[model samples]
Target: MLALGIEGSANKIGVGIVRLDGSILANPRHTYITPPGQGFLPRETAIHHQQHILPIVQAALKEAGVTPDQIDCLCYTRGPGMGAPLQAGAVVVRILSLLWKKPIVAVNHCVAHIEMGRVVTGAVDPVVLYVSGGNTQVIAYSEGKYRIFGETIDIAVGNCLDRFARVLKISNDPSPGYNIEQIAKKGNKFIELPYVVKGMDVSFSGILSFIEAVAVQQLETNEFTDADLCFSLQETVFAMLVEITERAMAHCDKKDVLVVGGVGCNIRLQDMMRIMCSERGGNLYATDDRYCVDNGAMIAYTGLLAFANGVTTPLEEATFTQRFRTDDVHAVWREKKSLPLKENGVVNPGIN
Candidate 1:
């Protein structure tokens, strides 16, 4: 079966067409570059989504050489995203589903990230570390469900990065995170920062405030370079994530790791994660831009899996949920008692 997926979770509008076998026929993204001082104001972000949603979807359909009638299912992000953007995408999906008489599936945005990583890496049972604009958590499949082993107790990782970038007057031109990464690369010194990890939950708010104070002090005394501060900040935060992930792997007895979500695209973080995984005699997996960042392909791929398991939401039942959790969804993979021995690697059942 063929499915068309629409995603407008935050500042990006993505559209994709995918086959049931997990091949992406077409994938396209429209990014909204927020102006300086905008700072995620809901009204401004909503306006951005209104302007680009339809065009991106149309472009994806044209590129895929398919029409609404040709698509067997229509899928869209149900929630765990910005409210206005979710509404915009849902309105379009509702209309398309009605017009084409196709079944519509509502998918959780976080689970889509997890499934996308699995699809790209073909990892049987990997410990998942999801870090994005709105979330950060460690997950694993167990007892017929994806369980959350640990997560952030306060602000998200991406949000913290963006806020710090704004404070530094870094350009949000291409991407705020990218600009932060560039500034961080030029950093040469290590500045002490707050590290808050309560039990299995992490917090970044205090760290953000501390960084701002340091920046203020440097400005007053003309004492430090922004690059050094940026480098120190990234190192401290990324190390926290690596520490938690390592702990989760040991607790869960997982030998494989998959990193997903927008922040997963960060090269520095990926490098740190790879080192941690290697030390544990395991491997780390990451999705390319196609799946790492928010996109329609992951949403469609996840929706297809949900649909196959007899899951469907009615038009009236459709509603946006901004705080959906990964553990809320049922696991599609089932652990088998007997492991199959192969020349390549250990294989698990229920995943193609």
Candidate 2:
């Protein structure tokens, strides 16, 4: 069986085709980039997706060497994203579903990332560190859900990075985070930034505020270079992420940690996580940008898993939301495990 998936939750729009055996036949995507010192708006981003979705879908099918008749199902990101962009993908999937007389599956954006990480890295039951432009969450499967162990109390780590890049007037062509990662390599100074980790949850708004309020002026004064700011921000936020992920792993008694999401492609973040995992005698599982960044292939593979397990979205219920929580999905595809013992002040009723 083959499935076609569309993803336009944020600035990126992707179309992918996947076989039932977890093989990605085609995965093509385009990102809606803004000028330096600017960020993408939801309305404009949605328009970009609307303009490119059809062509991207066509390109995916052609590259996959498949016909519309061969596709058994349709899938799209259903939530936890910009409403307008989510609607752009959802409407296209609905149209395709009706036109092709195929089934539809509404996949959670975050779970798709985790499932993609699992399939790509062969990680089994690993704690997930999901970091993206809009979300920062530490999660793991428990009972019938991908339980959220921790998350951002305010702005996400990626958003903080992107906004700082805007202040620095860095290019957003590939990604703000990626550009920051590149320039950070040249940094020699480690400007101490606010490090906030409240229990398992992290707060980046204060850090962002500090840098925006102080670091920008310091950059003009030549007290620190832009590279130094980037380096300091990455180190501060990634350390918080590593701390929470390790804490979640200890809480769940899991030996493996998987990083998934757009920001998960950061080399420094991966290095820090690897070090943390190694110190705990565990493993760090991550993928390159092709899989780590949001893509339709992840959605297709995840929706395929759900479809195989007797799940499908009805036309009337084919909807998207901006506030869909990760724990709300009833991940019926995985087997339920017994609860774990409380650790570090966290009570685990199941294996999260």
Candidate 3:
């Protein structure tokens, strides 16, 4: 079946078309760029989506060379995002559903990230480390739900980075995180920062506070370059993420670690996790910006999975929420037992 997905969960507005076999026909996106020392506001971002949704959807359909009637289903991110942006996509999705007479499926934003990671990388039953602006979670499947094994008790890792970038007046064009990564490559000095990990949960608010203070002090005294602050922040935060993911791996007895969400696109974080997995005799799976960051492809793919398995969101009950949890939706597609995975010198011998 062919599915068309609309994603405006955050500042980025994207449209994706996908097939049932996990082939992406078209994935296009436009991000709302804020000035330096600024963050995206929901109102402005939603307006951006409203202005661009029509063109984005048209571009996606044209690029895929498929008519609206050819689309088997319409998929959109329902929640766990900014309310206005979700509504922006929802309004368009409702209009498309009415015009084309296609079924609508609501998808969890976080679940979309996980499903995208699984499909793109073929990482079957891998422990998921979902880190983004609004969320940071370590997930494993259990009882028809993606259970949160660990998460941030305070601010999410990406939020911390973005806020810190604002303090340093970094560019948010591509992304604040990407700018930090670029600056970090030039850094040679590493400043000590607070590292907090309690059991499976990690905390970044305290770390951010300390880093912000250090940046302020250095700015006044000219003691360190901005690269030093960026380097220190990335090392400290990525290390905490790796530590928690490792704990989840040990607890679940899984050898594969699949990283998802926007922050998963970070090369430094991937490198840190890769080293940990290599030392522990496991594998680390991650994706590039296209799949890692929020996109319509993942949303479409996940919605198709559910729609084929007898799931639909009627217009009356179609609504969006800002606080939707990953475990809220019951996945009828994923099986309870683990799917076959390639053995990387861990517990599994071969595909059963």
Candidate 4:
């Protein structure tokens, strides 16, 4: 059994192939880089996906050393993203599903990230900290569902960073957040910023507003460097994130922490998480840019799991939405197990 997946929920367009055993054969991706002080538009991103979808698909197939006829199923991210981009990818997915006579599986974007992190990093049922441009949540599995333990109330972490990068007029070459991470390394001072963590959830809009105002003042007075602002933003925001994650871990009684999503690729964030986990006598598991960000391999692997468990999307029922909650999907693929957050970390069945 083979799966071909498409991921174009945001600025990046990715295609990948994976086998039934959770091994990736090929994954190719291209991101749309907007100029400084600008953000990605849905229509433009959709057009970008439409233009490169075929070439990237061909490239992925060739890299995987497989032909189109060898593919048994087609998968695409179904929701929780810009509608235009999802429709663009869906058009391709539907065409391929019809032309190749393969069943299509619509995977939840957030669930795919969790499944991918678990597969690649070998984190067996860890508390997942999913931080992406569109979402920020600390998730855990309980009662056959991935429940949101903590999340952002306003803007996502990555979106905050991206919008802040625009205020700083930084390059969006690879990504605004990535560039901010690099610049933060050069900063030594940490200016105090608003830290808001209500219960288990976080809010980044106030922090963003604070930084934007500081940037305006600094631009006129040259009082604070961009590096300092970047450093301050990362430290404050990541601290809030770590705080919430630790709360979730303590509440769930789980030691292992798995960080997924695009914002998970930040080295500083990983370091902070590692320190926090070590304090709790636990470990932090993360991935590189490949699986951490939106990619086709995650979709392929996740979709394969769903398909094998008798899940499929008919053409008429394959419509995408802008808000697909992770807990909405019934996770019938995983076994019921007891994983106390703080104990010995041994998973036992029949304890749910």
* lDDT of candidates 1 onward, in order: 0.81, 0.88, 0.89, 0.89
Give, for candidate 3, the lowest lDDT window spanning 10 residues: 343-352
lDDT per residue (tens digit) for residues 1-352 in model 4: 7899999999999998987667678889999888788999999999999999999999999998899899989999998899999999888999998889999999999999998887676678789999999999999999989999999999999999999998888999889999999999998878999999999999999999988999999989988899999999999999999999999999999998999999999999999999999999988889888789899988998898888888899987877899999999888777622111111122211111
Candidate 2 segments whose C-alpha is farther than 4 A from its true place = 336-352
Instruction: Kindly report which residue stretches of model 1 are placed more than 4 angstroms away from their true locations once superposed.
Output: 333-352
lDDT at residue 328 of model 3 (Cα atoms): 93
Cα lDDT tens digits for candidate 1, 7-69: 888988898887766778777988888775346665677788888888888898898888888
How far does residue 243 in candidate 1 sit from its true spot (Å)? Answer: 0.5
Q: Candidate 1: TM-score?
A: 0.93
By lDDT, the better pick of 2 and 3 is 3
- What's the residue-level lDDT of 250 in candidate 3? 95
Which ranges of candidate 3 are over 4 A from the true structure? Answer: 336-352
Q: What lDDT does candidate 4 reach at residue 160?
A: 99
- The TM-score between candidate 3 and the true structure equals 0.95
Every model's TM-score: 0.93, 0.94, 0.95, 0.94
Q: What root-mean-square deviation over C-alphas does model 3 reach?
A: 4.5
RMSD of each: 4.5, 6.7, 4.5, 5.4
Cα miss at 114, model 3 (Å)? 0.6
Candidate 4 stretches greater than 4 Å from native = 336-352
lDDT of 2 by residue, 181-205 (tens): 9999999899888999999999999
